[model samples]
Target: MRANKYEEVWTRIMFEKIEVLSNKTAITRTEMKQGVITLVKGLNAYFNKEISAQNDAEYINKVWNNFHLCEITMNLIGSLTPKELMEIFPIEKIYDGKKYQTKDWFSAHEAVQQLAQETPISESKEVFDFLWDYHNWDLHIFTVNVIASMNNINKMEKGRGLLEQFLEEQGVRTINKMDMIDVNWEEERDGE
Candidate 1:
């Protein structure tokens, strides 16, 4: 399949998984836990099949890296409370007695950085190191978007079109295009 088609399939699968979790009338901790496990297993199998079919080493490497990243991320999602998830993945920009910096919206990257720094000899630090090394900001945004949908912070759409639309918006487009431009979040936050 073409890249776009692959993305469509993946997005549909993700939406289906999230729907199963979110459609519950009163989701218990056990249900959430089982849902997360199922999600991880499903994703692992899907990506493994995709990875095995690839011929290019570079493409395989990219998918492999992404798979591990998603694995770690889903584990984190399962462990965190709704309140904590909300704090890390706020749907809109937030004010903290100052201007709204990009960092304040979907701040999981920053949170992970802080966690990695604060706990040098812990599993969080290890996970943070791996994520930082293969850091794809788009993935971070997508994960937060998923969490927001699951928690009813945002309504789940049918496919990846909404996410692509979001990424194409002016502000987000600029952020996604930048390399070193906005990497220094602390300076950006201070200047804002």
Candidate 2:
């Protein structure tokens, strides 16, 4: 249940614009980033230790899922609806429709930690690796969006930036996803 680093960032960013949900003091992104980094580092450390003892694939997948949760969470930051956030996350809202019970995200994180600790290394390992890869893609998408949001870029700019950044990360000079029919990866991955 615990949110990954991206979720933490998204949560903080969402708080900055709490007005999107209701009238509340906007939070500073700087403050939010600080807290998120601390949380991620701590979680990473904890995972490293727990994973070391057991190599369960299922438990590892849960960890990866937890990490990917953070990446998908970045989509929740700028202007997405609470329902959209819920769809991406496994968490159910305790509060009506107004706000995301922040505590729920925390609780989810704890659940992931427990799964990581309790699940056997063999069963959980494959899931863990898959989740880890899935989360990487999630992070790539999230980073593009987060940077765009921070720069106050519009949707068009965000899309362009995403393609550019993705290419850069892949060490390619350029990438084109415009021709959906011709793009095999997008067809196979459903454009994620």
Candidate 3:
């Protein structure tokens, strides 16, 4: 599902997969909670300065989206259900008179509404697509793999498709039901 240029296919997979798993009753709240925690921890390990070196923009370009994908999965853990959030978001303007929120911020608010429901949303798929265009809510596993591989002429010759690439990335490989990290980031951080 790799697109030649500026094509999007990764986020769609994250949304659909997370939505289904989050809603499945058999998955259990315990399972969901554990899943989200593992993602956060693995991501932390990867981004931890002990594991990663201080590098330039080129390094960030390679690792940023995996960091991003980890974040999206964390958010996806929340998007599974509907809940209130009093986040001190930069885009929220201190609840004071200020400029409008960015399109990314606004789209995130829209995504909360769309994914929280039990049933399929009645809104346009385009709207979901638009709202999820942001990196926080998107898993760019495939897109980034294509990008990271472009420099490797041999791997490019191997022609790994999106799923193949996703499997190769740590972002997807590290996810499992091993240990739960606690999803209380919201309860404590957001004071929900």
Give the winner by TM-score.
3
lDDT of each: 0.46, 0.39, 0.41
RMSD of each: 15.7, 19.0, 19.7
TM-score, candidate 3, is: 0.30
Of 2 and 3, the candidate ahead on lDDT is 3
Model 2 segments beyond 4 Å from truth? Answer: 1-26, 51-61, 69-192
Worst 10 residues of 2 by lDDT: 76-85
For residue 167, model 3's alpha carbon misses the true position, in angstroms, by 25
lDDT of 1 at 92: 42
TM-scores of all models?
Answer: 0.26, 0.20, 0.30
Q: Which one wins on lDDT? A: 1
What C-alpha lDDT does candidate 2 achieve relative to the native structure? Answer: 0.39
Worst 10 residues of 1 by lDDT: 151-160
| Per-residue accuracy of model 3 over 92-182 as CA lDDT, tens digit each | 3222222554344455555555553453222323322432343342233322432343423333345554445555564444224254334
Name the lDDT value of residue 44 in candidate 3: 35
> Mind giving the per-residue lDDT tens digits that candidate 1 earns over 2-77?
8556656665665576677667777665555455444544453344343343456665455445545465445555
Q: Give the TM-score of candidate 2.
A: 0.20
User: Candidate 3: worst 10 consecutive residues by lDDT?
Assistant: 84-93
Comparing 1 with 3 on TM-score, the higher-scoring candidate is 3
